[model samples]
Target: MATYNPIRDMERFADALLEGSTRGPRRMPMDLYRDGDNYLLTADMPGMDPGSVDIDIDGQLLTIRAERTLPKAENVKWITRERTPGSFLRQLNLGQGIDTERITANYDNGVLSVTIPVSERAKPRKVQVSTGAPAGVDSSEVVVSEA
Candidate 1:
């Protein structure tokens, strides 16, 4: 015998209400960090079709989209259904100094990894600093260029 709990029903109702507020796309959890000269991003998307994943870059915006579908069965009653299936989306704004042309993404074991390489111009470089005067040259003998 299954007993109906009012608290559980209320919780489900609240969840549905909140979920309905964002009808477009659900947010997927992700982590982003800079590794060497590249920015790495990883998103967790379990039980998703690899082919259903789509990534796009427009200007400074990076968008990731994926779909998760649950099979529907006939003449079956669900005692408790918690996992909602639909579209998942995540957007990030990549500012200047990023090599967008060489951006790469890979999905493995339900984890999506994105590599954003830093531009050559953006990479850290050491600027040579000259000290006092060269070998036999004296500071007073040095002639500054006249524009």
Candidate 2:
């Protein structure tokens, strides 16, 4: 008995045709982690020019974009070629507690790094609690527990 999968067959066909395609855009690999009061994002963009990298924020979406260019080829025999040059794009959701105004980005050694600081209003703080208040105080009372 034989089974057929349309999605799997389509993926295999695409891979065979686009394995060395340099005309379409692709996703850039990235890593994101939290350190202290800020979040650090590292993206791998080997052989990419520093001036081609761009970082922007629209509403709650943070986007990273870049492009790579390859030299034009003439009439010659080709033996081996693997790397494809094209556009790279990545987007992330910046939820609450992000200091968007102070965000920063840097590109060096073919890698892009972005720093996102946490907002002061989202940081944890200590709150004092009181037992009984004066009788003259408001009729409504509230209580808190340190435990």
Top candidate on lDDT is 1
* Residue-level lDDT tens digits of model 1 in 70-124: 8998999887777778999999999999999999999999999999999999999
TM-score of each: 0.80, 0.75
Whole-structure CA lDDT of model 1: 0.91
Candidate 1 regions with alpha-carbon error over 4 angstroms: 1-12, 16-22, 132-147
lDDT of 1 at 80: 74
**Model 2, 63-146: lDDT tens per residue?**
999998878899975553456678988999999999999999999898889999999998888998767776578746555669
- Residue pairs whose backbone atoms clash in candidate 2: none
